[model samples]
Target: PSLSLSHSLSLFLFLSLSRSVLSPPASLIVSPDRSQFFEYESVSLSCEVQGNSARWRLKRSTVFGERSDCGRNWGKPQGSSCIVSLIPSHSGVYCCESGSGEHSNAVNITVHGDRVEEEGG
Candidate 1:
């Protein structure tokens, strides 16, 4: 009887853990399809969330190791999106995160300067 009870308890715990691990996470999609851009051009990083959320924000990481907090707001009933103007300095990986502790995959962006023409005027 003692051995049977222990086995049942162990089985219950294993099943519960498996369910938690296998459950699907909240869905989020970021757009402006390609992640690359030019130095002075404007780029908007937007995301759509599917599921419950408390809040969200757009975070950017520059190639020079600087981080900037672009925008943040309460999550909408149907999800939310934000657009940020791009400058030469705003080049690198960007992503979105929910205040409820959810984060989207990182999108790498490369911003470059225009080529200079060397000639006598």
Candidate 2:
């Protein structure tokens, strides 16, 4: 008894699909790379997705609400990276997400200061 050619091809495709599905998505890397910061410090983050084509943006979460995109006012968007000035309000968990919803691991950031967090909206 032997396997048919179609069956072998189908098995190969299944293995490939399983590997892709099991692998993690893109990764988020921080520049000045520590998770701790003083107020007004500049923080930079970039996404590390293999073969990614500028389809991702930094997504953030804080105490006041659900997650949201790091907008232009928060920082400058250059290529696949974002540079944000750390105000206390900017203290939160940050991650990368493609517009299509693929996500990377989250990074927790803390801004040390006495000032109250202001509106990020």
Which candidate comes out best when scored by TM-score?
2
Give the Cα error of residue 103 in candidate 2, in Å. Answer: 0.7
The total number of steric clashes, by the backbone 3 Å criterion, in model 2 comes to 0
lDDT, residue 121, model 2 = 28
Candidate 1 residue lDDT tens string, 1-121: 9999999999999998886456523333444566666545555555544555446666667777776556432112223555555555666777767776556667787755662422222
Q: What TM-score would every model get versus the actual structure?
A: 0.58, 0.76
Tens digits of per-residue lDDT, candidate 2, 1-121, equal 2578889999999998897688646888999989988888898888888776478778898877767776744767877788898887888899988888878889999998744454332
User: lDDT for each of the candidates?
Assistant: 0.58, 0.81
Judged by lDDT, which candidate is best? Answer: 2
Name the regions of candidate 1 deviating beyond 4 angstroms: 1-31, 72-79, 115-121
